[model samples]
Target: MAQKRDYYEVLGVDKNATEDQIKKAYRTIAIKYHPDRNPGNKEAEEKFKEAAEAYDVLHDPQKRQQYDQFGFSGPGMGGFGDFGASMNMDDIFSMFGDIFGGRAGFGGFGGSGTRGRQQHRGSDLRLKVRLSLDEIAHGVTKKFKVRKDITCSHCHGTGAEAGSSSEQCPTCHGSGVITHTTQSIFGMMQTQGVCPTCGGEGTVIKNKCKHCGGTGVEKGEEVVEIKIPAGVAEGMVVNVPGKGNAGKRKGVNGDIQVFIEEEPNDTFIRDDNDLIYNLLLDFPTAALGGEVEIPTIEGSKLKVKMEPGTQPGKTLRLRGKGLPAVQGYGRGNGDLVVNVSVYVPKTLSREEKSAIEQFRQSDNFKGDAATKHTIFQKFKNYFS
Candidate 1:
């Protein structure tokens, strides 16, 4: 699939555009590319939907903040499923018809004629899950018992009692909308609005379901399964569509937003995808280098060779030993960094001090100018 255009670019707005500005931009695009204006024009319809999608994200404070911080593929942005793409032309009309001053399917100014009843969308649900470094590295699936509104079993989402059915709304005569005609300077103009009696459902239940009180929904619990991608960081959200509260009166289900929280690990310090381990070595081990075992994120140990006279602040890099990058951000896994530190005794016994004094007197054991200069250059390089 082609990469989605940036939300700002799609609506031709700047990143810092105000809410009103964003709404104005979307309205302009919607009017220009409306299917009513360009009937059967697939490209125009796509652009219209694209503009709506952009407007949907930019107009909402929370979604806009997420988009600004993480871009298209960020957490809770729902890069896996595009919302506008999943909707139809009728869905768009029902959603934003009010924005057009009630001219959606009315008989004036590029109207598409009368449309079906409006369908309401359920509200999104938010959840937070804590993950271990291992789980973040490998990715995992989690199950949650979510408490939210669910479709009523007795009414079967129709809002009607058993052995009963919904009848045409008498106010609008089943049209789900009321058309108002007025004579103005521009001649006779007709605008449409949703019927107040039936709330745009076109039908009304004479006998309401006792269980859900005619709303077609009730409080319930659902077991939802979510698959988390690897390399996700804290505060990032994963969206599970159609897993939130059920919409009223057989409408669409909302989404489940999963927030990620990372659990701290005892052995490693995380630096993005990289892992940092501070290895403390004894004086003998630092002076006469050998192989030392290092812990890995995979719950295993890796043996690393230490060169003779290994100095403190020396870093050893093991390639492909770190965490993997989040999908679509980058490629390949990160490296493991080992920082070496040599342990020094606070006090020395008399015999040990005498042996150390003999070595201190030797030229080989005494620090030379070249050695001091090398050490100074290393420190300079490190700081630089």
Candidate 2:
């Protein structure tokens, strides 16, 4: 027997993932490895079973807590049961049937061993939203109108017209699939295909809807409002459920994926949650302590003090002034690092040059005063 992989590892999620996160990950993995999507493949079957087992354990609160502390089988846990021997395809489907909008099978395909064609979820839509640094610092809500396919108002999502309905497909006889047998040297072999009469819907409408022309959907526009959380980074996807194109014949609606694009801040450069600002100080201000006003991300002025002898490349930290953590981890807010740069005069007047020359000749203006002070302090300490 092979060693069982960690539940979190199998689902491609962190151990500290929330229940929603765990379920979302399982849904993605289940769709990818579903048997209908990879028919007659043993590897896919094993992966499907593995995902089911992971979801079964992690979805249960008590089981998850015990699993986290003791792993598969420890003190109180009755061992992570074998998914292959325990769960049949129907069992797995029944457990998570609601994931596929109560279709009772893997998505994009029908239930196992059943030839009926299932309706597929609508395709996901992707769009980019540009947010300013201010908006990222504090959460913002935005609304945008998107054009997509929606169920026809006239027919209420059914292709049939008013006072008329659909009948079972005559070609496949409501089976939704057509099976044919072929003779070969070995013997007769059976093959199945979708019914041509109803196009896998198992029924054919006698009177089609005038609005959608029997498609049961039409182009429409809808306003989608999204609230962007604070501290969101570029390229992060915010999923809006059931906002994409409406599925054919009233199937499940898809998701709207909003990709974040952060606009550059003019006053500060963002690095993770921290903000960096370059502070420029004059020679006199660097030599003599003074206070200067700097712009913050929130369109406010922040007073920063420059200590006497403040040198270039020195960084001043302003705690709790940066953006909050997106995931609520680590310190919630970051610090603002003010990088000091001494400003040098491009051209100096005669009086300015004379004053500088006088300062250069002063007795207390030694170039290595800091070095001498350090040496004297070391000698005094040694004597003590």
Candidate 3:
């Protein structure tokens, strides 16, 4: 498949475009490429779907922020499949047909003159998932026991009970809508609205289900499994489509928005994908080179060679020892940076002090002019 266009680009708006601007842009594109207007034009249909998909993300604050930060590779983005190329005319009409000033599929400039009941989408569920640095380095799947609204078993998602069934609404006569015609200066003005008596549902159930009280849904619990992508950061939201509350009357199921929270690591400080570790060396180790073991994110120790005369503030890099980039970014793993610091003895024994005094007058013990200059510069830089 071809690479998807940027959401902002598809909507012909800038990153800073307001919500109203995004909605207006989507409306313009939708009107131009509407299926009713373009008929059998396959390209126009695709454009219409594309515009809908773009509007879906750009108009939402959270989704738009994620798209800006991680592009299409962010959590709950393009490939995860909520809405995009797979969107159909019915889905578009149901969600955005109001922009055309009528109920979806009802008679209007963009409608097909067919009355369809509005499907209620369930509310999204928000959850916070805490992860360790190791878990963030590599992707992990988690299972959650979510309590939300579910379809009523007794009614089987229909509002009718037992042997009783729904009958066509007498007010709209199964059209699910009420049309009004008025003579105006522009000629006969016609407008369509949802049926008030049946609440737009063409059928009415005389016997309501006791289990759900005719709502077709009830309080229930579900075990949902979410596969989190690697390299996701804290505050990022991962959406699990159709895993939230079950819609009323068997409409669309809601999504689960998983907010990521990262736990602090005891051994490493994270900078983006790179991990920083401060290694403290004793006087002997700083003066004399030695191989020291360092802790890694994978719970393993890596031996690093400390060169003789290694100074404080020196950094050693371990390539590919850090966290991996998020999928779809096409970036490699980050590095582990080791910061070197020397430890000084705060208290010394009598023998240790006497031994250090013997070397105090020695030429090797005393700093040369260049060494004094270097020390002066270090002190000046620190103070500055």
C-alpha lDDT of residue 352 in model 2: 100
Ten residues in sequence with the least summed lDDT for candidate 3? 103-112
Alpha carbon deviation, residue 282, candidate 1 (Å) = 2.2
Pick by lDDT: which candidate is best?
Answer: 1
Which stretch of 10 consecutive residues in model 1 shows the poorest summed lDDT?
A: 104-113
Model 2, residue 161: what's the lDDT? 93
Ranking by TM-score: 3, 1, 2
TM-scores of the candidates are 0.69, 0.65, 0.69
Cα-based RMSD of the predictions, in order? 12.7, 11.4, 13.1
User: Which lDDT value does model 1 have at 327?
Assistant: 88
Candidate 2, residues 215-301, lDDT tens digits: the string is 888899999998888889898888888999998788789888999999987788998889999988999999898999978777788
lDDT of 3 by residue, 1-384 (tens): 767888888889988899989988998888888876774599998888888888877776776777789987777664323465554565466556666656443223234545576566688899999998989988999999999999999998887789998899999998777776656323453456677878777788899999899989999898889999988888888988898888888877988999999999889999988999999898788878898998998889999888888888889999999989888765998999999999989999999999889989998768689988998998999999
Which TM-score value belongs to model 2? 0.65
**Candidate 2 Cα misplacement greater than 4 A, ranges:** 1-112, 115-117, 175-196, 328-331, 363-366, 369-384
| Count of clashes, each model | 0, 0, 0
Q: What TM-score number comes out for model 3? A: 0.69
